[model samples]
Target: MDLSSELSEFLRTRRARLKPQDVGLPEFGRHRRVPGLRREELAQLAGVSVAYYTRLEQGNGKNVSMEVLDSIARALRLSDTERAHLTHLAKPTVKKRQRAAAARPQKVRPGLAHLLEAMETVPAFVLGRRGDILAWNRMSRALFGDFDSWEPHERNMARMIFLDPNSRDLYPEWECKAVEVVSVLRLYAGMNPDDQELLSLVGELSVRSEEFRSLWAAHTVTDKGHGSKRVRHPLVGEMTLAYESLKVSGDDPDLMLVTYHAEPGSASADALRLLAQWGVDEPAKPADVPE
Candidate 1:
């Protein structure tokens, strides 16, 4: 992930999504060459000189101020997440880029692993950055296939979603699920562009899947911690599950606890119960969910 190229492409894509009238600017001509607002139009909207904005767009963000970035963000009508991504792309951490290729492994806490085991009737996974499943419980295995049998790199959600054929059958709205996964990965990339593992995963997926390639170029960003998903499970058929993704607050802020539960009275809940072996074969708590 080249910082300069990424910043240029991000700003270019964002600007290409907006029109003059979309931001209250009057439509001046019908023969516009570009799809969206011109560079001068954006500069005017941000109250900056065209030359300065052009320089920033070309990825020379040195000495740029947060105030100017915020003004540009407003002009582009960026969401909070997108704004944060913009800031990150403009001012990446120099040390992370200069650091060694080896990134420290992300770990899940022992207590959180116990909680995942206790969620016998619920499908739970302790995911690290880039959607790597560091640990998971039996219910999760029953619901989403046996993660224990997979190699460490194969346990990643993004990899499974895009490269695995079974994943297409798992999600009824596969495109929606794929977009969400890709968006989350991009958010991570924005903050940590120099993550070697993440880049390697992205490169592999891009080469293997056409869908992943297209979605990766879109540059969507989201930070929502909770959502609902409809999964087409092989054993239980199609069911809707609401999920919460909570970040661990202490030393491992990168680890996220993802838990999935069905509505109490819905058919999905009954399906989940069946997957848990009618509450009979639940396993004892574990010391930690191993990666």
Candidate 2:
């Protein structure tokens, strides 16, 4: 992916989403060619020269200062994630040498795997940067179905959400879930533009799923954190579960440990207990086991 082009398109899309009135600019009754604030208007708001801002938008501002970037971010009314993405695009840290030094396949630490196993009632899983399910607990299998059944390359959450037919039936709010997956992926893409696997995943999804393509084009970026999702599990039926996403400490900053829980004494909680019991009675297929 061309950083310059990505930066230019990201800025253009963000600029196009805003309106003159949004930034307290009065409508001048002039026929506007662009949908959002004009380059001059944005420049005025950001306290920069129109020429400089234009050059930045055109991907020609090589020596862009942090102060200028901040001003532009403010002018665009960008969110925290969007601002971070802008900074990354303006000055990416990953170089050709860094990209060439391919990362080894991620594995769950024994301690973390043991920790996950101990959480018998909680559905937990560790996800790699590209949403690959690196490791998951027994309850996680009960909640989200058998990850071991999937082909190694097909273990990505984004891929499953878009390509797996079962996912549509599993999540009642499929659209919302799908959007979140795309936004999170977009965030990762901004951070690691040169990741060949990630690029390939995006390429495949963009070609195969119209919905994914549309969301990807929107350039929305989001950080994964605590959230609630209502899912309809085939075995357990419908349940609203709260989930927390934490970064795995140690060498792998890109790996995330996600755990789902329900309110104490709630029906969802009971369902989880039942799911755990089911897992105990009939052991889930191990990750190494093929379908």
**Clash tally, candidates in order:** 0, 0
Q: Compared with the true structure, what per-residue lDDT tens digits does model 2 show for residues 154-235?
A: 9999999999989999899999999899989988887788888988999999999999999988888888999899988777
Look at candidate 1 and tell me the lDDT of residue 57: 95
Model 2 stretches with alpha carbons more than 4 Å out: 95-102, 284-291
Error of 2 at 41 (Å): 1.5
User: Model 1 residue 214 lDDT?
Assistant: 96
The TM-score leader among the candidates is: 2
Q: How far in Å is the alpha carbon of 223 misplaced in model 2?
A: 0.8
